[model samples]
Target: MSSTAEPAPAADPPSAPAPAPGRPSAPGFGQDRLWTVDEHLADILAAVHPLDPIELQLPDAQGCLLVEDVTVPAALPPFDNSSMDGYAVRTADVAGATEEFPAVLTVVGDVAAGSGSLPEVGPGTTARIMTGAPLPPGAEAVVPVEWTDGGTGGGAATAMSPAGPGDRGAGGEVRIHRPVEARAHVRARGSDVRAGDLALAAGTVLGPPQIGLLAAIGRGRVRVRPRPRVVVISTGSELVQPGEPLGAGQIYDSNSFALTAAARDAGAIAYRVGAVTDDADTLRSTIEDQLIRADLIVTTGGVSVGAYDVVKEALSSVGDEDEAGAGIDFRKLAMQPGRPQGFGSIGPEHIPLLALPGNPVSCYVSFELFVRPAIRALMGLKDIHRPVVRATLAADRTLSSPAGRRQFLRGAYDAEAGTVTPVGGAGSHLVAALAHADALIVVPEESSEVGPGTEVEVVLIG
Candidate 1:
């Protein structure tokens, strides 16, 4: 009997030396693969702590995380107000008034909103009131304003008295063609919310609707989670910032912009720190400055062992001694594209640093697979990851992955049918491939060969 229950499906086959036939390897690609996805993820997560304190103004605080609960200082609609523009009459006067034998009352003083007088509707009198106005004293029902007339045509039939015709001054009354019910058309005070009720709990992410709600409850300001400050630096001597003159062999620096946008979309304030050449000293100095003012630091390129690669060396310098120069941990994971992902602390400040490989596609993939979720959690986003689904492959292709590492292939997800299909050729440097992909197919480490009909899990990217 096998002890491991079906051999637990190998994550991927170990990379054989001289590499598997027909598969191309980057120059000097080693036979030994370093970190596993789970291993590196654990290390990365261990280095990060929740973000620090922040206070945002209420109007500008929509979509901001709440650091404290917001309770209603007072009941909604603080006082009993009318819900309709109608006549406010004493219930006693309209008790027996019906269409056949209507009760007639005199109309009294009109109560528009913001009026402070406490006008009372006596027995045979009524008061004209507007919606949202406080219910006049002794008012029982509000017959819509459209239902009442001047009453001059019927010889005082519209002119009625208050208190069922008891005292003087005509006292303003309402003619009721329909029988009255207790409290009908009258909105009771605090009916929507009790005084001092808890409107929202701590850690709540405020939305426009929630902001409106808070405003309704009289809260002009609210204490909310501070947005993390992220500095995105794209490193490459051959790159130029967008809108700048492109020298020979120079490509537009897009990683920094894309990553910055991604960070902002995750609810963080991001700054692009410009590009750095492959020089180790320059990279180190740039990161140090960013670290002092930044809560999160992300750098693209040079994480691999290529001669032009200095990100790995710079990161290694930042890792704890046995003291590397800095205190960062740099290693290649057993995955494609993002294989050379680096995570660790930098300088004396202990700033968390994530060094993604230079390949645009690689950088984006690593961020989506790892950093995005972490950022969302810190920023208190409701849905941490893009929705994923299981589906069958639409086409078949053979790709080699380390037996111990899982592979994430760019693809598209058909949500209605719950199927995922690869969007383009599996090329790590193909940025266009990523553009067309809507999701990522998670091919297991043991999946040496997957046919079109094979059931697989996909991580929705779009």
Candidate 2:
């Protein structure tokens, strides 16, 4: 049997190849007419490219890829400042000081942060300095208030009392109970970063820390690959919005909400459109209207051969005649539960679109296997696929799969135990099972049965 484990999907510069000759076609597909999962994924990735980088405010650029290296315009801290609210005095003045026989110094004035003017500290004198306050001239070190008498002329004081409205007199005395070394409790200039240093490199993903660093370096705006705007549409006449009253044979539209949330989780700015009815004209017009704001379009349902398959009928000839890379290709895949699929570019801009099956589990699995990677790729990320691991199958009975088809079964992966147990049966409509599953158990095309304790390739979803 051929290896079922496939490498992580990457963008390849080739269209999907046709089915091999003399190969038995899966049921409902014409003889030797089916595409492999890798082929479909490659085609989708190859067609989609990263969005152009744009300058955005720091807040808006969070989670985006930096397109250029950000350099520090000025050194961090800007100047030598106090790291503590304490007395800024010459190091020699505090030397040999002790609690029993402390060194007394005159408190000339207070030095607060952002103070334009300063008090110069001469020998036998010190200044009361707040945290982050610049060291006054002639001061070589800072002695924390805890190590001094806080100018109260008592035992070692715990804190400095604020001067009242009428108590603004700077004529006080402070007793230094301990000796402080040079630069003690003082932040040296450029200690964190130097001017012209590369703060962040290109291709770096900007997280909270990175954003903070950019702001620290005075970068109010930055250049980054913007998040792709994905428009998700679920098509079906029988589908109704959630929280609305349900009529006969009408089911709540979960695919749009699910796929929209999935797109966001994949680092996209996703918009969930109201479900479209089973009319080719409405579907086509809806897609055309969304093109103005969409970087990628995803639709669920109506890609199969059913007579009422609106997606296939609507998008079959969607490309403009003048457009080069347009038109959708509806094809069956050699996979279980998600055989019917459609992918191609449409509209004047030729935005890429993916049409998935209607079944809840199938639609969701197809999204993880295809849409997530596409979104990451559009964000200029190199690693676009979910993590995978090899695990032993933990099933009571042997698992059965269809030959010549790759089946992805939802499973509960016990990472600590390194075992994965299948969730629910092999039904594509099992949303409850999919909800409880954190991984997918892969069954290769050539293998129809998998016994317990056999190792299998598991895709970690959660």
Best by TM-score: 2
lDDT of each: 0.69, 0.83
Give the range of the ten consecutive residues with the poorest summed lDDT in model 2.
Answer: 1-10
Q: Over the stretch 1-462, how does candidate 2's per-residue lDDT look in tens digits?
A: 001122222222334344333221121232135678887787678777899999999999998999999999999989899998889999889899999999999988877777656789999999888888889899999999888877855445554543444443277799989999999999999999999899999999999999999999899999999999999999989888999999998888988999999999898999999989888888888888899999999999887656677787788655463565466777667887787777777877878888888888889999999899999999999999999999999999999998778899999999899999999998888888999999999999889999999999999999
Worst 10 residues of 1 by lDDT: 1-10
Cα RMSD, model 2: 6.1
- Score residue 243 of candidate 1 by CA lDDT: 90
Displacement of the residue 209 alpha carbon in candidate 1, Å: 2.8
lDDT of 1 by residue, 1-462 (tens): 000011122234464343223222222243245656766665555555566646667787877888888877787778888887667877777676666777777876667666676578776777767778788888877776445553433333243322222232233344557655667777888888878788999878888988988888888888876677788988888888789999997887878888999888777788998889878888877887777678778898887656677776665554233422235555557776577766656656566677787777778888887777657655755566767778977776654454655778888888787678787766666778888888988888666656777788888778
lDDT of 2: 0.83
